[model samples]
Target: MKPRKQTRTISRIMVPTDFSPGSAEAFEYAIALAKRLKADLILAHVIEPFPYNLVEGMAFSDYGDRLTPPVQRLLDHQSKRAIKEKIPVKTRLIEGAPFREIIKMAKRERADLIVMGTHGRTGIDHLLAGSVAEKVVRLSPCPVLTVRSVPAASKPGSGKARSKSKGRKANVLKDKATLI
Candidate 1:
C-alpha cells in the first residue's frame, strides 16, 4: 500500500517586533506572507526589563510601565497594515525576556511559523549583548524566518547622484567610533 502525502497547512503565523528598522522590514514581510497564505497573524512585542543597575534607582517594573504605551502604539500601527490587507491580526504585549516570551507565545498560540527580524550583529557586539532572534530561533517550537534590513545604498533606484554627497558623510560616520 502506498502512503498518502501529508501537506502542512500554516494557519497561524507569529511575528515578534522590537519596533526597530529591521523589525519594520520583518513586519512588512510577515504581512504580505500572511495575506498570501490566508493565515492569521499574531503580532508580539516583548518589553524587556532594563539590565541590572542600568537604570540606577528606577525599578524594572517602572521602566517597563513607562515604555508600555509607546511600544503598544508601535504594535497598533503595525497591526493596521495587516488589517488593511484584510488579514486578521492579534497583538500580544508581553514583559519579560524577549526570546523566552516569544517562544512561549508561539507555542501558546500554536503558530505554524515565526517571522522575525535579525539585527545581524557579529563578533564583540553580538557576544556582549547576545541576540533575541538567535535565541528564539534556537528554542522556538515552530519554523523561524528571519529578515535582515536592507541598506539604503543597496536598494534599487538609490542612484549615484544621491550617493555622492550623503554617501561620503555616511562613510565618515562609519569610520568613527559609534557611541551606543
Candidate 2:
C-alpha cells in the first residue's frame, strides 16, 4: 500500500503591512503562498491611536481623516499586485495597537494563516522596541509565519559581505517562534 500525503486547507491568508521593507518582503511571500494554495489574501494595515486628543486644548477631529488616505493608497497598491496575479484579496484598515488589531482581524476573518514581517532587532534594540510579529505569533488564533528582510549583502550581485553575527544573537530575533 502507498502512503498518503496530508494537506492543510487554507482559505484565507492574513498579511499585515506597516510599509517597511520587512513588511514588503512578507507581503510578497504571502502572495506566493496565496497563489500556491489558491487562497484569498487579507491585507491589513493598522493606524495607532494618536497620543493625545488635543494639542494645547485644540481638538483635532480630522486626525484619522488626514492619516487614512495615504495609507489607503498604499494598501490599494499592494492589493493590486495580488489582483494582477489573479489572487483574490481584501483590504482592512483598523485603528488600534498593531499586534492586537492583527490578531483580532485574523480571528474575525477566520484566516487559516497569518504571515507578517519582523525587523530582526536584537539585544537592547529588541528589548526596547518590542516586536509586533512576535506578539502576533504568540497570540494569533491561527498559525503565523514571520518573514525577515533579506540582508542586502546576501542578495545576488551585491558585493557586500554577509555578517556572521546573526548566529550569535538571541534566536528570537533570528527566528521568533522557535526561539521562544
Candidate 2 lDDT over 51-108, as tens digits, reads: 8885565456667777899999999998998898899999999888999999889989
After superposition, the stretches of candidate 1 with alpha carbons farther than 4 Å from their true spots are 53-57, 159-180
lDDT score at residue 51, model 1, on the 0-100 scale: 75
Which has the greatest lDDT? 2
- Give the candidate number with the greatest TM-score: 1
lDDT of 1 at 120: 77
lDDT of 1 by residue, 1-180 (tens): 999999879899898998887787677777767777899999999988867746778876689888888989988988988898899999999999999999999999999988888887889999999999889888989888887665666655646754553313212323221211
What C-alpha lDDT does candidate 1 achieve relative to the native structure?
0.79
TM-score of 1: 0.81
Clashing pairs in 1: none
